[model samples]
Target chain A: MIQLNISDIQHFSVGDGPGIRTTVFLKGCNLRCPWCHNPETVSRDTVTLTYPKANKSVTYGRSMTVDEIVTEVMEDADFYRQSGGGVTLSGGEPLLQAEAVAKLSQALQGHGISVLLDTAGCVPWCRFEAVLPSVDTVFFDWKTSDPTIMRERIGGDLPLIKSNLARLLRTDKGIHVRIPLIPGVNTSEEALTAIAADLRETGAKTVALLPFHRLAVGKYEAMGIPYPYRDTPPLPADTLRRAAEILSPSFTVYAEK
Target chain B: MGCIENFITGMQPPWSDGRFDTPRFLEYVFNDGKGYFHPSAGLNTGTAESITSMEILMERLETQLRAGVKEYVESFNRINVLPDPENYTAPFLSLFCKDCIGRGLDINMGGAVYPSVHGAALMGVGTMCDSLAAVEQVVFTHKDATIAELVTALKENFVGYEDLRSKLLAAPKYGNNNDFADKYAVWFVDFLSEEFMKYKTPDGGGYYTAMAANVSNIYAGHVIGATPDGRRASEPLSDAASPTYGRDTRGATATVLSITKPDYTKVACGTVINQKYSPSMFEDGRRDKLRALIRVYFQKGGQEMQINATSTEVLKDAMDHPEKYPDLVVRVSGFSAIYVTLAREVQMDILARTQQE
Candidate 1:
């Protein structure tokens, strides 16, 4: 009877996780990062996006029981088994509906499918505890090291987020600390050093630096909202390499384009 | 266009009591006596109403196999003994000159080093497998319709059976690496090749089964009736050995896995597994992924694959204004052709091939 608000389920998602995974974008996020690519998933309510040029309209946000989600994700179980991929629960924040996510993850795990959770870790530690029992891997996002920027700009509690990430790192589960390399937000030498110092304290070993892209401009256009970073060009390859160099001394770095 | 049932019935020789003169029958059907006739093996299996019942399908296939073997033997026997070789022209006679000088016989008179091994092009492996899977799933597994109802539905060309046709279309298809459907394809190649291998040419050459059907699929589809795979009466029948166009919703990897399930060693005449990709897949960085995919396919015993790298947008534009892109060449089955020179239906068929991303 438990239903989770869903945004979209993307199959053959190679970039989300290790192999050919199906990323289940759960509707609703607590954080408001300005450069967030998935703007439509920020709100819990259903929203429709219409693109005039493509003559296509898409509606996001639906309520589906865990059984329905399990059945749909299980359709690609063979692909997952073949390519070492499974389901990736990503979202505004996947831990928002902790109980439902726990149930969905448990059901998927029962079918021998690996479940990975991609979260910003802004929620309370209890939410992570609720879903971690069934999740095989955790892609914990660490946005910025500055407390004021985390609070005012991104609407995240730095202390709470850092504590949750540290606790997740303590567990035996696989943890991949992802840093979205927003140019003005977190790509500075000072900011990279600070973020790496904080991550080192949290005992994180591997960090994936995701370069910022303007691909979400169309999403903003469809949603009828002006993207703040529309005029900003993507982070150049050299800048991404510099950021990776700054973090290499603290943790193993992978600069993902 | 007449259906195969009507064609077969009309091909019954008047002099004989319900017995077909296989040579004359093939001559009238394929070549009109101008060229040779290679029996299209398993082309009509999916369109036959007996596909709803496996017992009847097996029986029909057995009868067709016997008739096809007879035609092969008769054609080879007749070609082996030509009374006079002097009537042929110089260019035609020159091909057998070495044989005539060395063995004092013409090529057709068994003087050539190798006997003529006829190539029986097995058309519509995808169509046959999809149709069988649809029947097994809809009729046997789901019990959504009975064999009698399905036969009637096909007889009516699914006019009032849209719901049934949708169910059939929604069933598990062949190109998704699902064993439920791919097993039928495996059996199809094994059974047909094993049976054809038992027969030999007059001078002892084995029959080679080919999955390459040039542009003949369009013509073959014209004669087939509504198939259980939800294909209408006159739609092109699943070009070459590839799946029904647009049915492979899964990406390229699953398609490669599904197609390589059949043993290609038994198919000495080669297969044409057509795959299309966006032009970007042929670019510098992504081209390596495509190369790796083909490497895996060949490593898994795939005999041959044909890839088209033109984007659908360009193809659509070419269709709209043929003069704009005269040099757009594309691989069609076992051969390549100038895109604008092909018929519109063939163009549409090429455009319908699922572009793997």
Candidate 2:
């Protein structure tokens, strides 16, 4: 009776994968990416978002057994099979609960469902090893190549993330390196070059350039938290193109608008 | 022909005079015509005659349709003289009617006079001709169940086969953000819209197509036999471009994603997407979520959306106790309707709409 601490199960998550997917946003992240979109899921504790304007409050972080979660996700099993889509396990950092994810993925695979794991890859190698067998695809996040930026700004270990990515690439699985081109942070030429060098060493085939957006500003306000990037507008199209130009030669670059 | 003639004659004063006056009535084919496209409308039903035969039939139908309009206009002109000063009730309003004309026809489409047929025939509006639930549940879903058994159950309206109806109810449905069923819906809109775009109205007014049938879907469903979508014979089809009742298991976001997949720009007349959300979704900052949902949908090329904020509880109450909620207005497709005024089954259908949280 393994229970998973999850924030929300987002059904029909189109932007997260190739086809229609159910994104299980697991609670609690290992890294503290300052520009994190889902701030509520950053903590393992049950977080409540109160909207003073709407006079509404929603409490996230629930403990559900693997069987219950699987049963809930299986409702769309027919959809997954028909559309070449399936479930995606994302998080605060799903690798933190690698053992639980392994069980979840095994159950989903038993039903012949595809599993996509979206992670920031700041965890140990054993976590990836434990979950990689059952997972079908991995959306590995690469925020910055600068060790100081990774440590001080996002609370991530650059060496550890790179090591995890390199090892994950060794496995014969669908791996997509996702780079969130944060403004004034990872958008510089030096940072992009370092990021490309790490991916090239790992033999990465595909890279998705996700430009920064202020979509989570409202959510931050609702949760009674001040967003540092509240005034920060979306990344310009030119910057996205520039980043794509830098990475396109090494890998298949897809600029996500 | 007689209807068109009467319509024109009734507006003699308004048409002939340099005045503008509202006619008591103006009934034309597109306004009230309820029929399918001409079989020669080029859908390639796959069982039709050779391409040559189809072309010949298409030419003949086009001639007849155009002639029908031409004859009506000629007869109206023959009987009444326009641009006359005497018939003018109001000079300003009458000025616009100088070029005004209307036409109607009973263009038959091989007895498949469904809304989708008219859309395709007149403007190539794509339609979900197939039901995913029907295919998933009745036709071939159950491992041991055969099509014969499903057909038998459907013919009997599942009266004696409660188990089969339950099974059918459990099948995959559209509007769930799942591509399996949504892909069909997407293709239906795209194909019909593209097909309809290849043609135009006789007067070249840009034949617009619509998926919104208003409350007429209830009546239309009444005449339709048991469909593959697990609908019983004469049971109301899904209301106004919406997925069947209680079939869309996913939330509103998924529904929007699935519905918006169809390219509605081709749907010049527009497509209607009806969704019911809990009133709370409209409150406070939560309304922004709904707003964002709509913005995303529109950005994705959705033509139109009609939202209802009535809770299922209130709708059910209105159905049971109509006197309590007389003024309860529900957006029925593109128009508003009193919830209590709708039929019980229709009310049931509205109640069954997934009220997104």
RMSD of each: 9.6, 17.0
The docking category that best describes candidate 2 is: incorrect
- Docking quality band of candidate 1, CAPRI definitions: incorrect
Q: Please give me the DockQ of candidate 1 compared with the native complex.
A: 0.14
Distance from true location, Cα of A240 in model 1, Å:
10
Task: Give one digit per residue, the lDDT tens place, for model 2 in B150-190.
Answer: 54554566688777665665556777766656766665555
* Chain A only TM-scores, each candidate in turn: 0.99, 0.98
Worst lDDT run of 10 residues, candidate 1 chain B, spans B11-20
| Residue B189 lDDT, candidate 2, scale 0-100 | 59
TM-scores for the candidates? 0.65, 0.50
Cα shift from native, residue B347, model 1 (Å): 2.4
Error of 1 at B97 (Å): 15
What TM-score quantifies how close candidate 2 is to the native fold? Answer: 0.50
CA error at residue A111 for candidate 2, angstroms: 0.3
- Tens-place lDDT per residue, model 1, B1-357, is 111111111111111001111121211121222212223432233333234455655455555555665666566556644435576323344353445446655555555555545546677878888887887889878999986687668657799999999899889998887899999789778876776677775557666566666767777776566778888776777766688889987777678778889997887656678889888766654555566667667777877788898899999999999999989999886578999999999999999999877
Report every candidate's CA lDDT. 0.76, 0.64
